[model samples]
Target: MNKINIVLADDELLFLQGLKAILGNEEHINILFDAKDGDHLIQQLRDAKTLPEIVVTDLKMPGLNGVEVTKIIHKEFPNIKVIALTSYFSKPFILNMISIGAVAYLAKNSTPALMIKTIEEVSKKGFHYDEQVMKYVHESITNPKDKKTKSTFDANYFTKREIEVLELICKQHTTADIGEKLFISPRTVEGHRNNLLLKTEAKNVAGLVIYALKNKMVSIENDSL
Candidate 1:
């Protein structure tokens, strides 16, 4: 099995060490590096021989801070997913992180098991949101800002099969699961997913779900997972 390489960034030394100890115990998780501040984290990323698959970072850090680092990573290293591990658990914090390209958000008090599960899910699905985060996403979609322009859906914009694939995706189905349910190969599912991303101009799978919800193409009560 391929190990999930990860970087951890937090200003609290005790907390950072604790995280290292916990994640280091997992066989499939490789702790590539740890940073005490956001600036250090960015430097590590720049100088590293192998970049990590995920960055688990605390929101409030010394120097650059997590928000600034997340934005930089989003712009500079789009391939590396960021999981916000912060003390702030308010709706604004969650939504802001999501909008800034964090693939997952976790409270600092969250259980190690949940963190592990989140890391696994994000690695497999390209994103992961807990029930709380999902609720926030639905609420955000339902009550969009006045400045935000609503997206209109065109019936012919997406093929019937593509819609099927997209619906399954919004339900958080893995590629293999979507393939089995749709009677298609995993490669075919991936192809359709890529097409959906291209057509909608979404950066990732999470964006696809948001696009579907914003366009009223998928119902939150029925389609969200």
Candidate 2:
């Protein structure tokens, strides 16, 4: 199997090295390099012949903070998946990262197994929302300020089946699960999903969910999702 290469960044020497050592032992995780700060990471990216699959960065750093780094990669190198390394986060801070295109945030004290699992999930699924992140996302639905009060959605554009498919997608149901619940073939489910992507103009599954949320199409407050 081709290993997942990661460029991990943090200003703290001990923590950075310790994390590198822990993740280094994993069979499929390769530490491409560890940067002391985001600026250094930028330089490393420029120097490297090949880009890594993931860039795990501290939330706060000396030269450039996680937000700035995330924006840079999201704009310049959209293919790379980013995971924010943080000891703590508020609703707005974490939400901003997600908006800026970072896949997830991992607590600094997280176990090595969870780190590996998150990296794998992000690499495969294009995003990973841990329980903490999911809880916050669910809560955001009920807050008036968090809701997109003005929607640009054209309800007439989507059929009832497409809307049901969208709600299932927002609920994080797999295609197979969705098909089983909806009593449709998996191939048919994919066709509907592609139509959702086309109509919503979303880039990926995560983008689709974000679009749905922004359009007030899916709400965790009402549905079990």
Candidate 3:
């Protein structure tokens, strides 16, 4: 199989080196290069012949932040994907990244295994937002403060598997958890999620929850979450 090409950006040189070492050991992920901040990353992108499939960036950087980088890449190089690996976990920051074009969000504490898996998933599926990000999206949209615009949901509109997947997602189940619960593989869960996103007309997993709650497919308490 062809390797997944990637560029990594972070402000701390030591952290970047550590991350580079960790990701470098993964045989499938090729570290095309590293940059200290978004501006440098953008310059690298412009200079490189073959654009990487993804960029792992820290939200806090010296020249430009991850959000700015993600926005620039989204607007200029639509084919390139971004995964934010940062300490900032605020609801607004996470939501802003997703809205602007980040395909994934990983807390700085995310395990290396999860980081690797997220990179692969986003590279293949075009997006991979973890449960934490999804939770914020869910709460923001479902919060009583936001005017809930009701939409008519027809159960008949979805297939049995699709509805099952949607329910698991609304419950904030991780891709692995949903796969285990449904006796499906993670790849299968990804497929179902992609379909749900399209069928529900939702932007991301959080949007799926909004769709579910707005249409009364899920309750506020969200016992599963």
> Top lDDT: which candidate number?
1
Name the lDDT of candidate 3: 0.81
RMSD of each: 17.8, 16.8, 17.4
Candidate-wise lDDT, in order: 0.86, 0.82, 0.81
TM-score per candidate, chains pooled = 0.65, 0.63, 0.62
Span of 10 residues, lowest total lDDT, candidate 1:
146-155
Candidate 3 regions exceeding 4 Å error are 143-225
Question: Candidate 1 or 2, higher TM-score?
Answer: 1
For model 3, residues 107-194, the per-residue Cα lDDT tens digits are 8988889999999999889988778778877876877532222112212346789878888887788999999999999999999899
How accurate locally is residue 214 in candidate 3, as Cα lDDT from 0 to 100?
A: 71
Candidate 2 colliding pairs:
none
